[model samples]
Target: MTGRRRWSTDEILDTAAELLRTSDAESFSVRKLAAALGTDSSSLYRHFRNKTELLRAVADRILLAAMDGYRPQGDWKQRIAALALRLREAFGEQIELAVVWGRYGSGGTGSRLVMEELLQALRASGLPDDEVPVRYHRIVILLASLITSEAGINTVAPKEYEQGMEQFRVAVLGADPERFPALAHFARDIRPLGADRPAAFEDILAAHLAQIEAQLP
Candidate 1:
């Protein structure tokens, strides 16, 4: 609002979103951003109130990008799985941005809207309208949890994370060769860690969606 030169909101947002994707919020300061864009830091103030507002816009814009060009067909369950995977893939590409997303307004408008759209799709797919919201909440929780977990693992102690997964495997499937022979035998292969986790998450989510579809029909 202060500058004579006109810059579209989309342009500003795209610039900010790109920064968020590549750098941590702490590192991506307004001064540095202006330097990167070859503009004065004060000039950005015309487009955004402050860094917080700019970050919100960035998160929203990235969400829009994630949801864009997504055209779904076939059974709704398949479509939903595709949508979830697309979002996960997009977020995975920008781990820092994903962390921002996890922390934004308990994860912001863009995220909430995506879930709403998925809930509507579920309802259209024969799920009860009222039930859709709760079910959708669960799915988003799982998705957000996975993203947050990955972000945490990347930032914190990697060794502790590996240990935690090992413990989880023992807790969930147990280590009882006498009683749960198969789980005890296959536990190592069943609970993979580190980089393999995201794929495992997608597979588990897809299976859940398939089960929901199975229940519907």
Candidate 2:
């Protein structure tokens, strides 16, 4: 890679996303990206207004990749469930990307497309028109909160801390039933630390959809 070579918009976004995935958001900057591309920071300004815009473009790329080849099938609940899982899978890869999305808001074509699909799925669920927006907001907020929680845990918690928590949970579950009856009774249903993330995410999405279904006429 030479500074003499001109980079296309797609190339810049792809490289930017790669940089984001490899590094933390606090350390990501237009200058850093330019240096990585063997170009000057000013060159990025032509494609993006600033670092925030560049990150948004990268986030859109991730969203598009996640939605690629995904078609909503089955009933509305099923369709929404599938879309939610796709959202989780897409942002789950890079926590910073998800955080960026929340900070800057999704204004790209990819965001619009996904939002439309989500609203359509919600409508198909037989939810009342007046309540659609409320439900939509709820779903979006839920996804963001869950992604943040999962990402924060991964980013801030060391392996030793996680292991210690697991050990404590085990100890609590193994306590005498006389003193910790509730813990002993539900021990089998508790998820261990570092449990299958995708599976747990899917379960959350499924439960959300089920709740929506219950509200339907």
What's the lDDT for all of these models? 0.72, 0.81
> Whole-model lDDT for model 1 versus the true structure?
0.72
The numbered model that scores best in TM-score is 2
Task: State the displacement of the C-alpha of residue 88, model 2, in Å, after optimal TM-score superposition.
Answer: 2.2
The Cα error of candidate 2 at residue 159, in Å, is: 3.9
Flag clash pairs in model 2. none
| Model 1 deviation from the true structure expressed as Cα RMSD, one decimal place | 5.7
Tens-digit lDDT track of model 1 for 91-207: 776777777666663245666668667876788789877777777877777777777577655664668877887778766577778987887878667744465776777887888
TM-score of each: 0.67, 0.80
RMSD of every candidate to native, in Å, equals 5.7, 3.5
C-alpha displacement of 23 in model 1, angstroms?
2.6
